[model samples]
Target chain A: MSIFLSILALVIILISAGLLFFLALPPKRRSRWGLRPIPAFSELVRVLGLSVEEGTRLHLTLGHAGITQPTSASALVGLQALERITAISSVSDRPPLATSGEGSLTLLSQSTLRAVYRLNNALDLYDPQRGRLTGVTPLSYAAGMLPIAYDENVSAHLIVGHYGLEIGLLCEAAVRNNAFTLAASDSLSAQAVLFATTKQPLIGEELFAIPAYLQTSPAHVASLRVQDLLRWGTVIALVLSAVLGVFGWL
Target chain B: MVMRSPVATAIAIGVGLIVLLGYLLPLPVLDPIRRLFLDWSIILAAVAGLVAILNLFKAHWRKISSSRERDYYSLFFILGFILTAALGLLFGPTDERVRPLIMSIQLPVEASLVGLLTITFVVSAVRLFALRRSWMSGIFLASTIVFLLAGSGVFLTSGTSQVIKEVLAALNILPAAGARGILLGIALGSVLTGLRVLLGMDRPYSE
Candidate 1:
């Protein structure tokens, strides 16, 4: 059982490493720019709504899992969601207060937000202290975020990436404040709660497709296409495995 | 002039081989090396954890000192952390009297917190249905209600119980696909990222 668990962990580690390489590598300049269609402009308006009419603080979490999360699909989706939130925050002058679990994600999220602030000339407005590197404990992260949610008078909350049941606590706290919430995750358990509790729950692949849907980034679109192919391949393999098992081939 | 970049590349290859070999082989030398790495990780975690405690103390101390809203909560937070750490460290963790004291405080407080959190979750779920009645939200809301109903085991103990179980089982089908595919993708991504770090393609860790 221990060996099986170890092997499973190793496989995830390897896969995450592969995707990081693709992200790190420079994209081909001429790669057809519009392969994946962006989500409709009207849909974006409807889905996102106006950024909290009062210009209140926005709350964003990168989830407990970091950039090197074992579940890359969710993290990829989370990165896209972060990009969208930061982009909008820049345009509206409503800086999003970000929190994170892991050290690596703290660094990546800082880069993502810094890029957004630089693009918008809001570099001077940026405060490094807000992007806190909270402890990795799920409940601890929740405990840290609770005070922020209360004190900041947050109007909207957007949480993305890989999560677990503890998300229930976070969402509950956010909702109690009557804040608009958008939650997403690759983990079924987390998604289950988000789906139950939030106004919108971006489940599974929806989280992965955020970049293409929101940013229209060609590399992200291509990555989503590859992801679809891989997903179908997995489905085929599962069917084959089940069939083999039933026929006593095992 | 300063030397050209080589440390990044060297560190990458060195760490990669060590990690890879650590997984592949279980030799005596490798065991000690793995133990050392693990110890280092623990040390790092301890240092990080201490920083978190300090930050929490500073933040909450201000809240209490300034008579801010929910200053009482900060008092509880500080006292809880301090007592928990103090009790465990001062007397060895295995002390008989300490065990019951820790468990007594932890069990009731943690239980109440968990229950409070769960109730908040249900309220949020209820609010989802009220706020957004769209098809997607409706589906999510429905799934949530079904899951909660099933979890409570309210439908058991009658001839119709089998039907209830089947319905609960059916709702879970889509999530299975979502979970499996995502996990496989994550696994593949992790390996590649680790490899890149090992091979010197990504240099965020460089000092």
Candidate 2:
């Protein structure tokens, strides 16, 4: 079983490497992959433009996760949203705010804001304060976000990462504030809360596709395609396993 | 644009490879090296946490002092932070006094927030159907209703039909199945993300 598992891992690695190489090729050589429209991301583009026109803040709220944990990937997705929103809204009168519940993520968000603003030649707009460590604990984090959600004149929010039921509190606040929110989380309970509360909720692994939707990066496309392919592969495996089980095969 | 520093990437890849190899091959030599890398990360994380606390202080101080956005509520934040820090420093983290002092405030606040979540969830679930008129939303509301009833004495009664009981039991399994699917997807995504970081295809840390 271990040997078979090792072989499976090797095969997946080789396939991923190959696909990434091919898909991430220069546009001159290979056409970019077309992604299906997610209503949340589609609505985000419209909301972002309106946010700028109205000069309202865009709050990018990340969850309580650092780079060391498994939920770090989800946190990175939130950071990607932060980077994208900051870059897009750099020209706006109000700069975007990135809030996180973890210290490392707070630092990373600040770094990300700085880099993107600099890349856009809007260094004057960059402030480390734009990236905030709102709170460390889950409930504290939600409570910390309340004032920002209620008082920051924020019109739009990109809430992503790993969160629990506490996210519902943030969502409720955003709703009462009449803010447009695009929320996603690695936690199942958070996802359920988001699904029920936020009009734009990215479910399950859909949280990881933020980069592809937000930016024009070949690397993002490559990884997304890898994910799509593997997801289908998993579906096939599950179906085959069920068939085997029905046939009394081990 | 992603590659800010190859040196950083190289360091990440080296440490990540060592850790990956230690997990995969279980070699004695790689194990300690992996442990050392993990220890370094933990130390760095702790320092980063300290930096976060300072950022929190700075942010609240600004809110208190800023002319336009003079949020007096920030004074409470400042006072609470100082008190917590002083207590933690004076008594150490595991001190009974410190734990109770923190927990006394934290537990109730958190519990109240969680209780508020129940209302928020109820409202959201009620609003969910209003916002989304799709079949998926219908199914979601139906399942939610079913589960609520099932958890109550509605489905588990002594006089309930065996078929109805079996149906409710099957419905209970559906959430577990759905949760598993979500978990599988997240796990795949995480692996891809970790692989990208390891292979230097994505430089989230730098870019």
Candidate 3:
């Protein structure tokens, strides 16, 4: 079983790498890969424009996941959200704010902010303080984010990361301020809670689709395609396994 | 469009691949190298924590100094940080006084937050129905109410009928199934993200 799983894993890697190199390398094809609309992202774009025009900041938080942890994939998505939003709204007087729970994530968020600003030639306006480490603990992290949600005149909140039930408090803070809250998390518990609390709740793998929705790059779009194909493949495998189990063909 | 930090990218990709190979295959040659990399990662992570503290201070300092956004409350953060760091440095993490002092403050605060979460959850459920009153919303509210009752052990009493137990058991599978579906998607995403990082096809580390 271990060897079989190992082979399967290797095949996935090969497939991903192959698709990335041959099928998805061209930049022109990026726009042609039509994506299904996620309502939250649509709302996000609309809210982003409102924020810029109304001169209010958009706050993006990467929930408490350290860089070395497996949950960091969610943080990566959060950073992508930050990058895209900052690129789009770098001209706004109030630039986007990114808050994170973990230390390495804080530094990374700062780096991403600087990179985006530089890319847009708004380097002089870039501030490291824009990316903040709210708190190390879950509840404290949520508490730390409340000010950004409430006091910062934030018009929109983008929360895409690994989070737990503490996300409820963050959502509550945003909702209280009447901010447009779009929250997604890798954690099941967080998603379940966020569905009700957040204005726009991103479910399951929808969080990973942020970059593609933002039209960041071809790689993001390609990865979304890869995810779709692999999801179907996994569904098939599950069905086959169930059939094999029922028939005593193990 | 192009690699902003080619050297950094190459190093990240190489280190990632080596560490990945170490975990995947039981190659003796790679184990020590992997261990060394991991130890280095731990040290770097600790340093990163220190950097975060510095950043936290810097951010709060700005808030305190800003004329319009003069958050004098930030003085509390700066003071608390200094005290905590001094305590931790004077006596190691395992010191008896430190744990009690930290937890004494953390416990009540976290407990209050958790308590507040329940209220938030209830309020949000009401808000959800108020905002979107559809068939799906109805079903969601009904299920949530049912689960809240079930969770409180109201349905598990001796007076409850066999049918009730059986139905509850069956309904429980729905959430488990939903959870599995979500987990599968997250796992697929993690796998894809990992590959992207390892291959250096996606670099969140820089532009």
Candidate 4:
């Protein structure tokens, strides 16, 4: 049993390494892995060019549950969102707006925005007065954000992280306000439930794909490949287990 | 407002130590201290909740007073909040009538508000197709549509529902696997993030 366990572990590691190496290469190169780069918010500016007028405002939220998420994907996505928003907003000549559900998220988000905005020489765009404490309740924060979504005439709403059923309300509000919504989360159950409800949905590991998509950081790319390898390994394991069980080999 | 009052600083330090000791120490002597701090924390949290209630009041009052559009909703919210607060406070949690009142008032109102919110999301989902298309959108669109239809108990109920079975089977596989993967991922991420917070790699807490 110990030897078998070791072999299984070794198999997983080898596959994972192969995946990482394959994904590290650009899409143009031929490799065993086929990792597609998700477009970053920064690329949006380059593609459309910076709309220096009141063209579109991007509203982002770090979902409530992601604050306590074991994996920092929620927070990482939150940071990425902040960086992307500020970078795009700076050149676009519009203040990228954001709202957060948790107190900690609100604080971190604001800080990230400030840091990026300062780096971009758009310090004035950074609202120094806003703090982390948005509100205590889930629906209350939703209620608070609705007016901002409406009044800001926001052009795009990008929601990332772990969310709940109540998030649908926020999405709906964005839709009603004529803003395009892009939401991504790492939870399967929530994704299962929310996919039907959201105008834009991101399911499963797709939420973690943002960092790899934008920074093309080796770590991010490697992590994403690791996830994919892990997923496929589990699938193969399940199939083998089922076959063995059918043959009375259990 | 003297700059950084010493007494306030001392109190903060004292509270901080108590909280730390409560979390870190399991010694018998510290148990009572921990319990006392726990009780105090609850009271403080309730007071904090009171402050939140005040903020809510002020926000709604301004809206109503200014006679803003949809101000009527604020009035209803205020009334409901007040009613719940009055019942919860005056009768306390043990009040026999409180449950019924809560069910009658809180249940319906919260349900309606949340329902309205859900309906808006449905409308958004319907209109989303006109917006953009990408793999992310594709996954979101497929998942959402299936989730809603399945959750509503409108699918796989009739005899001629091969489509529902295929959809449900596909959806079910991802969720279970995704749930396991996500749980593991979250556990690892939380540990790293907590370390970052503790080590001050991520700190908005300080200026």
Tens-digit lDDT string for candidate 4 (A127-179): 63232333456666666667667765577767776666666777667656756
Model 1 scores a C-alpha lDDT of 0.62
Tell me, what's the RMSD of every candidate? 6.1, 1.8, 1.9, 8.8
Candidate 2 Cα outliers beyond 4 Å, as residue runs: A1-3, A28-32, B1-3
lDDT of 1 at B155: 68
Q: DockQ scores for all the models shown?
A: 0.24, 0.64, 0.69, 0.12
lDDT of 1 by residue, B1-207 (tens): 011247755955775577566766555677677667657655665565456456556666666777446476778767877887798899978889889997797667657767777787767666776756678877766765676676676766576666767876776676576577666765433343345446554333332
Give the chain B TM-score for each candidate: 0.66, 0.93, 0.90, 0.60
Off by over 4 Å in 1: A1-55, A65-95, A101-128, A133-137, A176-178, A208-225, A240-250, B1-17, B24-39, B62-75, B79-88, B139-207
Ranking by TM-score: 3, 2, 1, 4
Off by over 4 Å in 3: A27-31, B1-3
Q: What's the DockQ of model 3? A: 0.69
lDDT of 3 by residue, A1-250 (tens): 3767767777788887787565466857545568987887888899999899999999999999898888999998888778889888989989999999999999888988899888877789998889889998888888999888878899888989988998999888888888898888999999888888887888899888888899887778888888988999999999999999999996
* C-alpha lDDT of residue A139 in model 4: 65
Candidate 4 collision pairs: A70-B186, A70-B189, A70-B190, A71-B186, A71-B189, A71-B190, A107-A132, A195-B144, A196-B144, A196-B145
Chain B, candidate 3: TM?
A: 0.90
What ranges in model 4 sit over 4 Å off? A1-55, A69-75, A91-93, A121-125, A129-134, A187-194, A197-199, A248-250, B1-109, B121-207
